[model samples]
Structures are given as C-alpha cells and as structure tokens.
Target: MSQSPIVLTGDRPTGPLHLGHYVGSLRQRVTLQEQYRQFVMIADAQALTDNMGDLSKVRRNVIEVALDYLAVGLDPAKSTLFIQSQLTELAELSFYLLNLVTVARLERNPTVKEEIRLRGMERDIPAGFLTYPVSQTADITAFKAALVPVGADQAPMIEQCNELVRRFNNCVGKEILVEAQALIPDHGRLVGADGGAKMSKSLGNALALSADSAAIAAFVRSMYTDPNHLRVSDPGQVEGNVVFTYLDVFDPDKAAVEELKDHYRRGGLGDTVLKRRLTEHLEALITPIRERRAQFAQDPAEVMNILRQGTERAREAAAATMSEVKAALGLSYWN
Candidate 1:
C-alpha cells in the first residue's frame, strides 16, 4: 500500500495558543492527522530568535503548547509531536541551506518583513531572525513534507523554502529536496476581541483555548462592536463587529446566529444581550478543552516522555535526510 503524504505544521512556543490558532490551523490539524503522516513541531528554537533573552519563557511554553495540542485532539499516536530544538540535524541542515539564500532575499520575504516591523526591529534585526526562513526551509525539507498548513501571511516563507529546494536540487544535478505547498484555512483569520486585524497572544487581545468561564465572559464583554452602538435602540453595523465574527465561526446554530444578526442590524438588540449569548456559546466550547488541558497539565512527566519519544522518532527521520543531503553536497566523507 502507498504511504500517506507527509504534512508538517507547528506553533512557536512563546505562549498558549489562542482562538486565532484554532480558527486558522488547529481545527484543520485535528482532521489532517487522520489522513496524513503528520508531524507537529513545537518550534522552541524559532521562538528564541527574538526571545533569546527569555529562555525560560520559551522552555515553559513548550509543554504548554503540547498540552494545548492534546486538549484539542492532536493524537501523538497519529501525529509525531516533537520539539524543534532537540533535533540537531535540523540546525546542521539550516547552515548548508543558508548558503543558498541571500540577505536581500530574506529581507524581501513579506512575512519576515512584517515580523521585523511588528517587533520594531527594522533598525536592529537579529541575524537568526533575519535568516529564519532558511531554518524553516530546513525544518520542512528535513521531513520531506509536501503539505504545510499556514496562515495567508506565511505564503512568502513557503515560497522561499521552495526556492531553496529548486536551487539546491539544480546545484546537485538532481531533485534532492522536496518542495512544499501551503494550506491556508478557509475561515481566514479570527479577529481579536478588540477588533484588531488579527488575534495575537503578544498583543493581549486573544482569548486562549484554556481560558476559564470568567475570562471568556470578560473577553466577550470587551469585544469591539459598533462604536456608535451606544444604546439598545440604535442600528448597528455587523461587518467589522468582532462578536458576530466569532459567532459565525463558533456558534453552531447558523439560523439563530443569522436571526440575531438581523435583529442587531434593525435596531432593537442590545450589545449586552448579544455579548451574553456569545459568552455562553464560547464558554460551552472552551470548558471541555480547558478541562482536558487541566488533565494533561496534571501529568507533566508523561507529557515530557511523549515529547522525548516523538523527538527521537523525528531525529531518526532528520538524520536519514541529513545523510542524503550530505551525500548530495559531497560532505559525507567517512562512509
């Protein structure tokens, strides 16, 4: 029988994943695991490109992200859940791949450019930060993953990875590396509670998957609706309304949600009433995930063991690929 196609995806271990993650990638991961040979990486090394000063935070969130993964139904039995920094081969591969790329090319990557601008590092971008696309190239090619699920903003990174793939294959006179394609989520991006263009943990505008009932309620109450919606009898705009945006994704009762939107637009439904319904739906959705996360958090050792085993499996695959990569570049000397 033919083997399943490999799918590589991951999260940076800087913070607990939020609803943005769920809507953008997490939900897709749960389904993809059943159909693909999936590898879910906890990207600690990449997280440290900017967070080098906060090593503890990065280390701590590795387990936190793993917990989130488990809570959301990413079965280790189906998906290889590994820590990125544990695989030394990936770093070695990245070094060789870096020679194939240039500073000008890295700067032109839209995802990298936006990240640098967001961190206010335009004047002082870290070397690692600037060249991370190469490292990402190493991560994807190491696993020979054909499918990489990512946000729309990350399309440039995948393009850069494929460029290196084609360049390295041409230099070697053969296709030594496999190119990857990005799988963007259909829901697009989930807006932040404050109505930002995106929901981000660092921005403090996200609702985490592990949030409690009180936190969920508070977040919903603070959600950005029509600013002109000052009273219960005013016609409200729903286009950019964060509450309806979330309801459209989370609330299963589509007909009810549409009716609520109609009532909201016609000038009788209060923001408080709408927010209360949203809070209830969000609470119902999150409570089970939070409980599962708590169960896993109670057994940190088992979680670490799972990561160790996954890393070992990942190391084997990476080591095999590195050997081929070395042979292609004529670096395998002691054979």
Candidate 2:
C-alpha cells in the first residue's frame, strides 16, 4: 500500500493557544491527522528567535502547547507530536541549507520582512530571525514533508522553502530534497478581540483555549463591535466587527449566524444581546477543550512522555534524511 503523504505543521511555544489558533489552523489539524501522516512540532527553538531572554517561558510553554494539542484532538496515536529542539539533526540540516541561500534573498522574504517590521527590529535583526526561512526549510525537508498547512500569509515562506529545495537538488545534480506545497485553509485570518489585523499572545487581545467561563465572558464583553453601534436603534456595520467574525467562524448554525448578522446590521440588536449570544457559543465550544486540557495537565509526566516518544520517531526520520543530505553535499567522508 502506498503511504500517505507527510504533513508537517506546528506552533511556536511562546504561549498557550488561543481562539485565533482554533479558527485558523488547530481546527484543520484535527481533520488532517486522520488522512495524512502528520507531525506536530512544538517549535521551542524558533520561539527563541525573539524570546531568548525568557528561557523558562519557552520551556514552560512546550508542555503547555503539547497539552493544548492533546486537548484539541490531535491524537498521539495518529499524529506525532514532537519538540523541535530535541531533533538536533534539524539544526544540522538548517546550518547546511543556510549556505545555499544568500543573505540578500533571506532579507527579501516577505514573511521575514513583515516579522521584522512587526517586532520593531529593523535596526538590529537577529541573524537567526532573518534566516528563519532556512530553518523552516530544514524542518520541512528533513521530514520529507510534501504538504505544509499554514496561513495564507505564509505563502512566501513556502516559496522560499521550495527555492531552497530546487537549489539543493541542482547543486547535487539530483532531486534529493522534495519541494513542498502550502495548504492554506478556507477560513481567512482570525482578527483579534480588539479588532486588530492579527491575534497574538503578546498583544493581550487573544482568548486562550483553556480560558474559564468568567474569562470567556470578559473577553466576549470586551470584543470590538461597531463603534457607531452606540444605541440599540442605530444600524451597525459588520465589516470589521470582531464579534460577528467570531460568530461566523465558531457558530455551527450558519443560518442562525446570518440571521443574527441581518438583525445586527438593520439595528435593534443591542451589543449586549449580540455579545451574550457570542459568549454562549464560545463557552460551548471551549468548555470541553478546557476540561480536556485540565485532565491532561494533571499528568504532565505523560505529556512529556508522549513528546519524548514522538521525538524519537521524528529523530529517526530526520537522521535518515540528514545522512542523505550529507552524502549529497559530499560531506560523508568517513563513509
């Protein structure tokens, strides 16, 4: 029987996952695990590109991310959950791959450029931060993953990965490294609770998947709705309203959401009423996830064990690929 294609995707262990994660990629990962050979990584090393000062935070969030994954239905039996820092071969491969790409090209990567701008690091970009695409190429290529599920915004990173794949193959006069395709989800980006273009942990505008009832309620109450929607009788615009966006993504009843949108647009739907509805849906969606996360968190040892076993499996794959990479570069001299 032919093996299923490998799908590599992951999150940075900078913080617990939030509602934005659920809508954007976490929901898709649960579905992808059944159909593909999925490798979910907790990218601690990558998280350190900007979070180097907080080593403890990175270490703590590794288990936190793993717990979130388990709570969200990414089965250890079906999907391998590994830690990126554990796979030393990945860094080795990244080092070698870095040689194939020019610094100029790395600087030009749109994703990297945008990240630099967001972090306000234009004047002093870390070497690791600038070369993230190379590290990502190593992550994808080391596993021979042909499909990488990511946000639409990450298209440029995938393009750079394929470019490195072609360059490495051409240098070796053979196609040893396989090119990857980005699997962008149907759902667009999830806006922050404050209606920012992006929802981030550092921004303090995100609702964690493990949030309690009161926290969820508070977040919903704080959601950005139409500023012009001051009075119940006033018509409201739904163009950038965060509450409507959440309803569109989380509410299972599409017809009901549409009706709510119509009611909201035509006026007479109080912001409190809309917020209460959103709070109910969000609570329903998150309650089970929160419960499951609590159960997993109680046994942190088991979670670590799961990561260790998955890392072993990942290391084997990475090592095999590294051997081939070494041979391709004529660096396997002892052999």
True-vs-predicted CA distance for residue 151, candidate 2, Å? 1.6
Off by over 4 Å in 2: 333-335
Model 2 scores what on Cα lDDT? 0.92
| lDDT per residue as tens, model 1, 90-206 | 999999999998899899999989988888989599899899999999999999999999888789999999999999999988888899999988888888999998799778899
How does model 1 fare in lDDT? Answer: 0.92
**What is the C-alpha lDDT profile of model 2 across 184-294, one tens digit per residue?**
999988888899988987898889999999999999988989998999999999888988888888788999989888988899888898889889999998999999999
Each model's lDDT comes to 0.92, 0.92
Report the C-alpha displacement of residue 48, candidate 2, in angstroms. 1.6
Model 1 Cα displacement at 108 (Å)?
A: 2.0
Clashes of each: 0, 0
- Candidate 1 residue pairs in clash (backbone atoms < 3 Å): none
In model 1, the runs with Cα more than 4 Å from the true position are: none
